[model samples]
Target: MSATTLPIPTDAGDLPGLLWLPEDRDEPVPGLVVLQEIFGLSEYVQQRCADLAALGCAVLAPQLFARLDPPVAGIEDGDDVEAWLAEGMELTSRLPWERAEADAIAALGALRAHGAVDQERVGLLGFCYGGGLAVAAAASAEEEDRPPSALISYYGSALPTLLERAARVEVPSLHHFGTADAFIPSQTVEEIREAVTAGGTREQVRFELHEGAGHAFDNPHPALHHAAASEAAWRLTAGFLAETLFPRS
Candidate 1:
């Protein structure tokens, strides 16, 4: 299904967001706030949002890159992988982490307040840059006593710096990482696992390591996509959302 443009109210102003709703929406359903990778809300991200909606979710993805000078909603991947990566990284650098984090929380609030969403069942799902934002937002939301019901982060690129706040995020969470990720080494991933899981104390947390998969393995880019790992990660993510947000009655 095609997504409609939704305006998310934030402290700075209304952030543009893309929203997707299930075709058979008879009542309030679980909602998810999808954060974008450094590439912004690209086609791949939009497709993933649609996929979530197909599974009976009210999905909203905020345009984090809109805060830029020219306001880039998304960027197209180019032939030069390094150049494309550098461009994305530069865009993200322009948008301060604090602003992005607040925008993420605002998006969650907007999703919770949406008419089609079950506020209590709202969660957060993000990839790459957004994955890390999801963790930060989840923690901030929890601090404000508005925790999401669930969280699924795929190779959170900023996770290393956000580990300090892990204690505040007690909701059901699933984290996916690549063993061969050059951006985030295996050692750091293990550290992340330890912090999020609290040394195996948190039963509600789940961490998966995708063998041989590099960062952003789910992205369809020729240099990034790992078919086997992507399929497995999506399967796990779908199942996790099913159990946490849309449990069988």
Candidate 2:
């Protein structure tokens, strides 16, 4: 129940993160990395870390932008958000997406190496930008090190683009998209579905379409949230997590 900020030990540097531990730590806990959206670790992202902790996992959400001024920040949402997101995307454009890929892998590594964490039982959950990070994380390594047992993405950005190189994402990946997404049209969604099926194994990949939600449907911001889509996505994400990462636990 108590959530606190902590440093995530990484070979690159000491990454800053928010740690949420269960009220009862009677046993070693499963590990999880809640990758941030482009907006960074905002209240919504932090709350999600808490939610995962309540599910019995030791969760850490790293401040990936710590090197920048204001180690922790929430991107201001407005007409400015588009520019901010674009600039943020540009910053990461040079950021060796592969390195971010490694960092997600290292997060799981650090958790496993923590001794307090059970390495065998690990998973990742991401949203928006992080959702894409989740898939890249899943696709980044061999089964031994970065074996992402489960994957969940909410209106993941750049998915269709990545589908062009879809073979890279061989792990169990699940996607949720809003039917009315201005960013991704119905035709594009259908194309993405085709790419999903063509890109990898059908049995391991699943897609869900929400009736009337746009991008970032899961977030609670009035300009973005869709009640029905958000609820449905959450239910499906939770179920996927339970089945893939903790099947026998």
Candidate 3:
């Protein structure tokens, strides 16, 4: 499904977002707020949103980089992996963490309030930088008593710092990480697993570690994409979202 421009209302102002709905929509459907990676809402991110919509979800992806001075809508991948990584990191550094977190929460609210979305069935999904932001947003939303039904994060780069609030995020959640991720070490991933899953006591939380996968394994870039891991992770994600967000009776 193709995505259309959506303006999300926030305290600062309306942020530009992209919304994708299932083509066979006959009634209100479950909603998902997809946060962007450090590279912003690039083509890969939009394709993922389309994938979710194809699964019968009302998907909304907020353009977090739009808040920047130049308002970058997306970043193109280049041959130089190191340079591209540095550029993405620089862009993310320019945006304040607090602002991005609040914007993510606002996007969730906007998605929940969408005409085609069933408010109670709304969830959060994120990748890379956004993966960590989803965790923070879920925690904040829970504190406000507006928790999303489900949460999914793929290689959340900021998770190491957000562990303190993990307890507040009590919703059903699925976390994906690479065992070989250089950006986030294996030890750190284990720590994240411990925090988010409450030392394996939270039966509702599912954490998957993909072996032989590095950071951004799902990205289509030659340097980052791990085809096997990406396919496996997507399979797990689809199943998780199916059972948690839009289960059939």
Candidate 4:
């Protein structure tokens, strides 16, 4: 696994970012932005970058919390997720959410300048808070300048509140949710569907609900993660990215 740390410049602030590339690959590759969960860019998020690198995609993960507080390096899902999150909020709360969104966009520009990325074929994938941002960022882009060919969101619970904007998402999208997500109730799912439909982006939205799962179902910890749901979502995400970003000519 080969990786490096880079910086992103935005109007709000400068942010640190991580880039992972497969070993012995000298050719330009499609880029994929791996947004972190609210816990910050912990080890799991870095590991996901390596995982995507193994798939031959150049992966970049921006440390959105850098301006507020540099988060811990490795944190797995468990009872402690909230504790780590509290630490993160201390720094993040200092930075306006609007700024973070701008930083997310800036990270893409930085990645494009690295010379190893296919600018026209970028993709964005995020989990938890990042998941909702992934949808919003992709949707917010104008068709002629969109950064992502595909968007993947895992348990994008906050989206319902921002549905007015999220509903504008027109890129081909794959969304995974736990049927039992306490964060996003079943009734809310129906409402989200209505919003997506209202946006007229229904053809671009593909929603899937996993049975016997809950929030953060994709985390690896058995106590906090649902193995079946995690694995299932991974498969769907893989297929979606392959189809959208690495499609056959």
Best by lDDT: 1
lDDT of 1 at 15: 94
* Candidate 3 residue-wise lDDT, 11-117, digit = tens: 99999999999999888999999999989999999999999999899999999999999999989998998899899999999999999999999999898888999
Stretches > 4 Å off in candidate 3: none
User: Model 1: which ten-residue window has the lowest total lDDT?
Assistant: 160-169
The CA lDDT of each predicted structure is 0.94, 0.73, 0.93, 0.76
Better of 2 and 4 by lDDT: 4
Per-candidate TM equals 0.99, 0.85, 0.98, 0.89
Q: What lDDT tens digits, residue by residue, belong to model 2 across residues 210-229?
A: 99889888887777889988
Candidate 4 lDDT score at position 205: 76
Report backbone clashes per prediction: 0, 0, 0, 0
lDDT of 4 at 85: 55
Which whole-number lDDT from 0 to 100 does residue 138 have in model 4? 73
Weakest ten-residue segment in model 3 by summed lDDT: 161-170
Model 1 misplaced regions, further than 4 Å: none
Q: Tens digits of per-residue lDDT for model 1 on 10-58?
A: 9999999999999997889999999999999999999999999999999
lDDT, model 4 = 0.76
True-structure lDDT of candidate 1: 0.94
